[model samples]
Target: MKTSRLSTALLIAYGIAILGFLYLPLVSVGLASISKARYLSFPIRKYAFGWYEDALTSDTVRDLLVISLKVAGVVTVASMVIGFFGALAFARYNWRFRKTYQKLILLPIFFPQTVLGLALLMWFNALGVVPSWKTAIIAHLVWIAPIATLVVSIRAFSFDAALEEAARDMGANQWQTLREVTIPLLMPGVTSAGLFAFLLSWGNFPLSLFSTGADSTLPEWLFAKMVSGYSPLVPTVGMLTVATSAVLVFGGLILAWAIRRLRPES
Candidate 1:
């Protein structure tokens, strides 16, 4: 009993340590955001919210938010659709070149994002395509779609094929079986995949760095500001971005909970 209690105490301590490690930087950024001084210093002497207000009213900040939202929203939708079919193919259907196809689809995930972004940039140049938010979508898709597929594939692998077969046996056609049986079963995974895709795309920097030539997303704008000079608005905007992501994530969780509650018990 003593050993078990000691182990539990250690585990709790470890978990707290992990959470602190992960969120301490965010806490620092939050502090910097509220600092009233032109230069940031720890154990802040004065605090103010004016920088956040400045960020809110800045035209550049608004443009960055819009572009980031557009990119993330489109990527989320496309990732969900592509991931649904891809996960089915990956974990359900077995066909010729299945291994090869899986490897090819996932290859991009293994590549360094910086190198991948540069290669994508060169490819666009070769094709005489201009780099823009539209191209950034393609770049993000290359990296994010595979991750979405992997996410959904976890749920797909656990799916009971017998349920699908049972639907077919009950006089359902291919489309009907998919609609009534497969899709409903897979919806949870698809939703989770979309959440991952949106978050990843929203925070993506490397790929967006290369692909969004003239148009800048929030991260890109933040990077430019950081490199050029320190702006108090940087941390303010950072906190705002973090807040937006947190809201979306919490909203998704609440939505999922509501869905589970509303769903009829089988």
Candidate 2:
């Protein structure tokens, strides 16, 4: 009993240490953002919202943030549409080379993102497409769609075909039955997938670096700023991005929970 208790205590301590290691930098940045300092340093004395005010007011930062939001929005929608169909097909059908098809769809996730980005750049150039905001959207979609499909597939594969059959038996056409039955059941996974796609798009730097052209997302903008010089506003911007991401992630969790709660027990 003593040995077990000691082992559990050690495990708890290890977990706390890992959490602190991961989050300490982010926590420090958050504190620095609120500090009334023109330069970041230890021992934050006075706290204010001035840095946040500057972040919001800066035209370049504002434009980059807008770009991030727009790109993320497009990626989220596109991922959902692609994921929905891919999940449906993968879950509801069986065919020759099914496993091969699954591997093909999920290839991007396993590939190194930098290589994927570089390959895409070449592919786009070969196709006579200019790298721009549109190209960034395409690049992000390539990386994130598979993730969305995987997330949605988790719920879809668990779905009983009986429910779909009942709908069909009641004189429902394929489209109507799918719209009324399949979609409702898969909404939780769909919502989570959208959130994943959005967050990944918003934070993606390596992929965006190759395809963003002159239209940079916020993470790209942040990287440029950090590399160029020292500015307290850098930490502030980082803090804002971290906080926004945290909120959206948690909100997505709550939404997923609510969706499950509202869904009828099967």
Candidate 3:
């Protein structure tokens, strides 16, 4: 009994240590954001919101934030729409070469971000299109859309095909059944997928680094600032990104849970 108790305590301590190792950087950045000093350091002498205030007051920061929002918004909408349609086709139907195509879906998820970014940069350049925010959106769409498809497809598979057949047997047309029955049932999954898309796009760094040629994104801007010098605003802006991602991811989880409650899988 004593040996078992000691082993359990050791496991708990190990888990906490691992968690702390992963989150310590974020905690440090949060502390730095509220530090009285300009540079990032531990055991900050005083706490203040001056860095956050300064970041908010900067016109450059504001513009970059706007660009990031716009890009993320566009990417979110586009990815969700594409993902939904792709899920419908892939999840609901099977045909020749479907297996081959399914394998292709996993490629983006497994591909190295830096390599993908560079490849996209080369593709755009070859077409004589300069790297711009639009290209970044396009690049992000490739990855996030697939993720959305995977998320929505899980729900799609859970959806009973019998309902649509029943609707047809009752003389309902395809479009009418889709509009009335399909969409309503799928709304929660679609919404949660969209939130994931937004979060992924908003926090993207490597692909944005390559595709956002002249236009600046928050990640790129933050990188530039960090390269120039160490300042509290760096951590402040990072904390903002962390907070936004946390809110969105958490909201998505809640939405997914509510969906399961409303439509429990049989």
RMSD of each candidate relative to the true structure: 1.7, 2.3, 3.1
Candidate number with greatest TM-score: 1
Q: lDDT by residue for model 1 over 180-255, one digit each (tens)?
A: 9999999999999999999999999999999999999999988998888788899999999999999999999999
TM-score of 1: 0.95
Q: Per-residue alpha-carbon lDDT of model 3 for 86-110, expressed as tens digits?
A: 7777687777877777788879999
Q: What CA RMSD would candidate 1 show?
A: 1.7
Lowest-scoring 10 consecutive residues by lDDT in candidate 1? 1-10
lDDT of each: 0.95, 0.89, 0.86
Query: How many residue pairs in model 2 have overlapping backbones?
Result: 0
- Model 1, runs deviating above 4 Å: 1-11
Q: Which tens-of-lDDT digit does each residue in 1-266 have in candidate 2? A: 35788899999999999999999988998888888887778899889888889989999788888888889999999999899888987776778877888989988998899999999999999999989888999999999999999999998999998999999999999999989998888887888899999999989999999998889888887788778875778888888888789999999888778767876763
Q: Give the TM-scores of the predictions, in the order they appear.
A: 0.95, 0.91, 0.89
Please give the clash total of every predicted structure, in order.
Answer: 0, 0, 0
